[model samples]
Target: MAEKPAWLKPHGRPWTRGPGRVVFENPWIEVTEFDAVAPTGRPAHYGLVGFKNHAIAVLPIHDDGCVTLVGQNRLPFADYSWEIPEGGGPLAVDPLDGARRELAEETGLEADHWREVLQAQLSNSVTDELAFGFIATGLRQAAGGHQMDATEDLAIARPPFREALRAALDGHLKDVLTLAMLLRAYHMAREGALPAALARAMLG
Candidate 1:
């Protein structure tokens, strides 16, 4: 585990975990049931979900301020979700390399510029699923079209950046990584981190 940054002061007492037993195991995730002592000194039973890969998300923004969106049916929630291109890469691999692969495989797009915008712990309460989000610009079509997974049936679209951001705010798109990346881009544009004309196109 990585150490916490030295700048911040420590707070309350931390929870101490005890012996654990595996309740479930799979290629993607593992659930371990453990006995722990909470910060309040109370005994608690907890189930920790561990992931085998890091989630990599890519927001492919075109020079014209258009963004690539992929829609697919998510079985867990039994709903169709529209999101930026995302997939999993092994924990031992570089996230940027994973992001590049995900972008090409899902949208058949290559980006000349890549900026990592966000790192988050998704559902940290029970799971340690960490995610990395990137902004990919200067986009162009890949030599071959998308090579979707055998089980994937993605619906692809290119909507203006503003419209996509609006969809996320309106609850039409609720993927965590997608929401964070879009808002990050908006902040970047407002702060002049992006080119003026490109920012204008996105803000429009």
Candidate 2:
């Protein structure tokens, strides 16, 4: 086996993992509780929620600098949420495909261009949920309208990208993936990573 990179090498003593078991499990997630000996020689108990699928989010931007958003009642919070088109992709499946499906299902939109923008862990301390985000441009409405899940009652909106950014900054859009993707889009626009005209329109 190849030697590990310097950064990957352990700097000091590592935590010692003790006994662990699954406390609860469902189609989407599994909860595990474990005991551990910390590097500082302290004993700790931890509970972690492990996700079965990768989270995927897509920001669909039209030529007019408008973006699609979806609003739905989220079960965990028991409140209505406004977020970019998002869903879960099985860990074995390609996340980009999931992003495309979610965009179409939630907003009836498709894009000619796609770029992977972000990958991250959601709530690292509590869950092992991983997320992937993408930016999709050159968008057009699909011939058929949205085909949402039976449990979904989604509201769709097409607002200028600037407006959406403002909403996110003002805390109206609270979804972590949505906020992160929007901020990344803004960074790309300002950094000239996006098309000049589109960036100008988005920042306006």
Candidate No. with top lDDT: 1
Worst 10 residues of 1 by lDDT: 1-10
TM-score of each: 0.94, 0.91
Q: What are the runs in model 1 whose C-alpha is more than 4 Å off?
A: 1-8
Which stretch of 10 consecutive residues in model 2 shows the poorest summed lDDT? 9-18
Tens digits of per-residue lDDT, candidate 1, 127-194, equal 99999999998999999879888999999999999999999999999898899999999999999998
Candidate 2 residue pairs in backbone clash? none
Candidates' lDDT values, in order? Answer: 0.94, 0.91
Q: What does candidate 2's lDDT look like per residue over 1-204, in tens digits?
A: 468888986666787878889999999999999898878889999888999999999998887888889998999888889999999999999999998898888999888899998999999978999999999998888777689989989998989999998999999999999999999999999999999999988888
The TM-score that candidate 2 achieves is 0.91
